[model samples]
Target: MAVKDRDRFSTTTRIRLLGEQTAARVYRSQTRRQARRSRLTSRAALLALVLCTLIVALAYPIRQYVSQRAEMADMVRQKERARQRVEQLRDLKARWQDDAYAEQQIRKRLHYVMPGETGYVVIDPDAARQSRADQGAADRPWYSNVWDGVDKSDASDQ
Candidate 1:
């Protein structure tokens, strides 16, 4: 009877100790999980920092690269335009080299005619009248016009 009482007491004590140990293990595991979560937050912060740093470091260079590419394209367009201008000038030079074209340009610009050809000028009467009205006394002979200008200036001075 004393042995049975001793066995029962020991078994109850063992069960109580086991339960305490299991609770301690669960508490330790929860603490470890919280520590791991904190560590993950720090690591995430570091990753975000690195990403922001990369963006700051690379932004100016990326912008410059894009702008330089645009400038290069503009230079290419200017080169093409210069090439077209050169071609146009060469064509104009070729046209000017011809005697017939030169003569036509002279006749059109200077109103000249070939020798022994009668060239008639068609004048607009309204334009002629306007010009005559605007001529005043200066359309006369040079001496008369000068005398008239001198007389006018003398009269103004008096």
Candidate 2:
């Protein structure tokens, strides 16, 4: 009976030890997994921080680069316009250098004719009448017109 009691006690003690070992193994594995998860979370957080910082730091320079490119495009357009204007002026200058063009301009603007040429003056009667009606102090002598303007300014002041 004493031997049987000893075997029973030893068997019970071994079972208890086995249960405790299993519980300890499960706790250790859980802690290790939690540690791995924390490390991963920290790494992800750092990566996100780095990305945010990069975006903030690059934002202003990127914006400035885009704006400068737009400004450069505008400047190029203005330069093209100026070049066209220069080309037009050069063509006009070249035209004016020709004696025939100069003569034509003089004839058209100043109503000039060569000595042997008979020039006919065409008049619009209505336009002539309107001009005559519109003529006032300006048609008078310069001295009289000046005095008339002075008189008008004086009257307005009064």
**What is the clash count for each candidate, in the order shown?**
0, 0
Give lDDT per model, in order. Answer: 0.85, 0.85
Give per-residue CA lDDT, model 2, range 1-158, as digits (tens): 99877876897877987899999999999999999999999999999999999999999999999999999999999999999999999999999999999999877755678999987667677656775337575443455467777888999999
lDDT of 1: 0.85
Candidate no. 2 TM-score? 0.56
- TM-score of each candidate structure, all chains considered together: 0.61, 0.56
Writing each residue's lDDT as its tens digit, candidate 1 over 37-140 gives 99999999999999999999999999999999999999999999999999999999999999999999877656678999997667677657775336656343
Q: What overall lDDT, based on C-alpha atoms, would model 2 receive against the true structure?
A: 0.85
Clashing pairs in model 2, backbone N/Cα/C closer than 3 A: none
Q: With candidate 2 superimposed using the best TM-score fit, by how many Å does residue 142's alpha carbon deviate from the native?
A: 18
102, model 1: CA deviation in Å?
1.3
